[model samples]
Target: MMVLPFLVAGWIFLVGVYGMVTSRNAIHAIGCLAVAQSSTYVLLLTVGYRRAATAPYFTDTPLRTRVVDPVVQALALTDVVVGATVTASLLALALQVRKRHGTVDPDALTGLRG
Candidate 1:
């Protein structure tokens, strides 16, 4: 119910976006993109968080007890997996670009104009 976590997530997202927008190198941009993706973890956790709530496992907890949303937690986990995959693919593409163009600078990759 706290607003601080949500604000923190938004701040993290904006920072990542700013870094991406200002990044000159492809690798830096990829890192920034990962940072941006990380904000979703914060946001998802915030959304699912409950004060004094138990884990989703109900093995020992009473049925009336509050528990965090399992669906949101699953979504967060899936987001992490997808983010890592996307980051890896982008890095591989960047490596290929550097190998072929001898540079990772977005502004210098004029060969991509075709």
Candidate 2:
């Protein structure tokens, strides 16, 4: 059970990497990069998950029972925000590249050098 999440995350990462590598369009590559970034969230969530764990609230439940780690969830949220920011920035850059070059093809981007 513990290994399943890791395997899934690895598979997602590989698929995203393959997409990026095989993509001809800059926008497509950026999307693939975002997909690659999503694997981190899965890994973090999986790491934070605890079987039969309850919320950290001080309800009728005792303090000794299993409770998932809040820190990892927070980290995952932070990662998501960072990923969104990066994706937005990359997309904007890609748009600019497309406007300047009139094409989003990676191979035709050689003339973009300074």
Candidate 3:
């Protein structure tokens, strides 16, 4: 029960990579990259989970002292921002490619040249 999500996330990450590699269109490849990025987030959150740990936020309960790991959560937040920036940049490039070549096909865009 506890580790299932981790396993699933790992598989999802692999599948996303496969999709990205096999996709001919640049936009589809970018979508696969986003899926892979999401899998990393799932892995991060899954690894940070602890059984019987208290919520991340402070609580008034007298006996509850455990706190959810904040460092991993913060790292995940940073990763999300980085992924967003990368995706945005990639999409902009894809748009340029589409405008120049009239297609999003990476197979057709770059042929022995920039």
Which prediction has the highest TM-score against the true structure? 1
Better of 1 and 2 by lDDT: 1
User: Could you give candidate 2's per-residue lDDT for residues 1-114 as a string of tens digits?
Assistant: 689999999999999999999999989999999999999999999999999998766668775888989899899999999999999999999999888889999888889667
The TM-score measured for candidate 3 stands at 0.86
Per candidate, the number of residue pairs that clash is: 0, 0, 0
Q: What is the per-residue lDDT of model 1 for residues 29-112, given as tens digits with 9 covering 90 to 100?
A: 999999999999999999999898889997888779999999999999999999999999999999999999999999999988
Model 3 ranges with Cα > 4 A deviation: 59-64, 111-114
**What is the alpha-carbon lDDT of model 3 when measured against the actual structure?**
0.86
Q: Would you list the C-alpha lDDT of every candidate in the order shown?
A: 0.95, 0.92, 0.86
Deviating ranges (above 4 Å) for candidate 1:
none
lDDT score, candidate 1:
0.95
Off by over 4 Å in 2: 58-61
Residue pairs with backbone overlap in model 3: none
Better of 2 and 3 by lDDT: 2
- At residue 96, candidate 3 shows an lDDT of 87
Reference-based TM-score of each model: 0.97, 0.92, 0.86
Worst 10 residues of 1 by lDDT: 54-63
Write one digit per residue (lDDT tens) for candidate 3, span 40-96: 888888888887887777667456577779888998899899999999999999998
